[model samples]
Target: MPTEFQKRAGVFVGLVTCLLLPMWRSELYCYTVLCCFILGGTLEYWTAVYSRVSSLQDWAVYLILFMVWVLPTMAALHIYGGVIGHTRLVECLIIQLVVGDSAQLIVGRSIGRHHVCVKLSPKKTLEGYVGGFVLTFMYGALVHGWSPLNISVVYVFGCIGDLYFSGIKRRLGIKDYSRILSSHGGLLDRIDSFMFAANALVWKAFFFSPE
Candidate 1:
């Protein structure tokens, strides 16, 4: 197993490549990469739950398939259509996924005294959450000029989504979702927060757009 530093480095490198390559490439490339992520994440989630819950395996498979796969794909399609009229939406999403989550992990490990949810994720702390929000919001504001409301919405929902999946893993009694990403866990482990944040972004574009 890789050390904590090694794991963090691995995740950072992978996130940068996956996020920037498609963004700098083309819309079709972005769509293809997003689709692949959604599919892989769905499979990872399903696999994580399969052996743990024998009685609900069938239903869990379908539910994760929809939540992890279908929903994200739909949101990606909307984001791709220039819903926000800015290609920076993809960059913002990546910021939320990479910076926010990474900050939480690093800060939580360094000086995380107050546990946010000891049962679901023992290592999580209030300080870590705050650090993540600050870092994520600053980066988003600089890169995409995201409003306060946008930053708050995505941060809150992303944390919620991450905790929700953490609860699932706790229930299943698994350390990581899968070994697909080595020390980083599974694809779902990486993008679980993005799934929920993407949904919120889609809703914001549709129902709350000033245009």
Candidate 2:
């Protein structure tokens, strides 16, 4: 098994590659990358939740499919063309996932007595969530603008999304989604928050943006 530092370093490298793709490539390329992630995450989710063929149910499978695949794909498509466009949106998403999540982990470990959901993710805490939101809000405001509402909404949904997936993992009795990223777990674990936040942002952009 890789050490904690090695795991974090690997994740950092992956994040840097993801961030550079949009800046260096076209919107289509970014979209393609997003599609790949959505597909990969979907498979990982299915495997984690339904480890055996007999454990799968029709409704549950469909729901998982929609949530993990369809919704994120729609969000990715909209994000590719929304006012912010794919590049900028992806940049912000990466920042929220990387910086925001890092803050959550650090703060949670250092001074996190109140667990947000002890059963789902014991490492997560209310203090960590607050710290993450503060950092995320500051970063978003600095980069995008003083869009407090948008920042708050995205951060909230992101945390919820992370917890949602964590709950799934706990229920399924699995440690990580997969060992695809070595000690960092699967792609789904990394992008659970991103998928939810992207969907919310795309919805806001599409139906609520001012002309």
Candidate 3:
């Protein structure tokens, strides 16, 4: 059932795990991995959205888009004064993303009646929004073990972030940023949820948290 892209991506992800897990996981290591993932994902996004872009211009668009995702990462890594331990920050970002995506699946399967964009992504719906919110909030509960925040703040912002990126994809007239992920699509498709959730986490940790 898996497409060629899925098989390839699965392998690549496995490779990444092997390559990175042995390094002892420093902030610098996290930063580098985050940087590469964002850059690859951004390239996928601009390529998918800007339909009129030529292959030559893809580089330019990618470079421009890279900034959109990168500055936030840098800020979170360096300037984020939040008391979030590295493990907590990582856990929150990854978990919220997974929750948001699971929400999409639930909404699509159940109440996704109205088309999100009609043409761009027909299955996306307000129902999915609810799913994403609930899931994201629930996942945020995991962070309470290590950090601060009530459920409302965590899921609300996290869901908004996922929807924000989803909206961007819809407007760009593409799906999943790229088909590079096969069933998963490009790096952007997989990571958009992460970007939104990470940004939300950064905001909470640096600006609002009493800790």
Candidate 4:
């Protein structure tokens, strides 16, 4: 029961992922994939944000903020040659983004109990947020290493990032960004969590991590 866009995107993602995982040895491999995701994510966000705007100042401000915001986040996630040379850091974040958001939405819609933001996204509940956090926290335990502090920070930021963009949806006066995906909204609609999650993880890994 997939929409045409979802079906196409799903197949393409599967194909690319299958091919890309093996070539993770190359820095270019992971960078290319993450770059596509960032571009797509930013585009969806831009579309959602700009769709309702009628003012030039609003458009200019949003454009500048997006470039200022998203690109730097993607750059931070790219693990180059060094300790993380062979690490599939960027891919790991993207994977979690796919799984984490999808699972949270399913849970939130079906049985979520507490409300995240009753005004912006009434569907988001505390249970869904908790559920998503628990899932991603476990993943972060593995991905962010054994540091308790790092794991906590990553979880908090990931959830906050999702909520942050939800505000953008409210500002733009739209729901789901677009109807392109049957279950999902748009690319940015989905990857908003990754936007902040990746930056938080990178920051923790470099500066805030335990010695």
lDDT of each residue in 60-129, candidate 3, tens digit only: 7655655766678667656533455455555654455544556566666677776564444456677776
Stretches of candidate 4 above 4 Å error?
1-26, 48-50, 77-95, 106-110, 139-146, 178-182
User: What range of 10 consecutive residues in model 4 has the weakest lDDT sum?
Assistant: 79-88
lDDT of 2 at 132: 76
Kindly list the per-residue Cα lDDT of model 1 for residues 1-211, writing each as its tens digit. 6778677777677656876665656766666666787778778767876676666665665476456546654665656456653354566566678778887888878888899788987888999999888888888788767887788777888888888788878777898889887667887787778777766666676777712
lDDT of 2 by residue, 64-182 (tens): 64466466556556554756577656665756687678778877777878886888788888988888777778887897673887777678878878887787777667878899976
After superposition on all CA atoms, how large is the RMSD of candidate 4? 4.4
What local lDDT score does residue 124 receive in model 2, on the 0 to 100 scale?
A: 83
Task: Output the number of the lDDT-best candidate.
Answer: 1
lDDT per model vs. reference: 0.73, 0.72, 0.59, 0.63
TM-score of each: 0.84, 0.84, 0.66, 0.72
Query: Sorted by TM-score, highest first, which candidate order results?
Result: 2, 1, 4, 3
The C-alpha local distance difference test score for the whole of candidate 3 amounts to: 0.59
Looking at model 4, residue 167 earns an lDDT score of 73
Q: Give the Cα error of residue 79 in candidate 4, in Å.
A: 6.2
Clashing pairs in 2: none
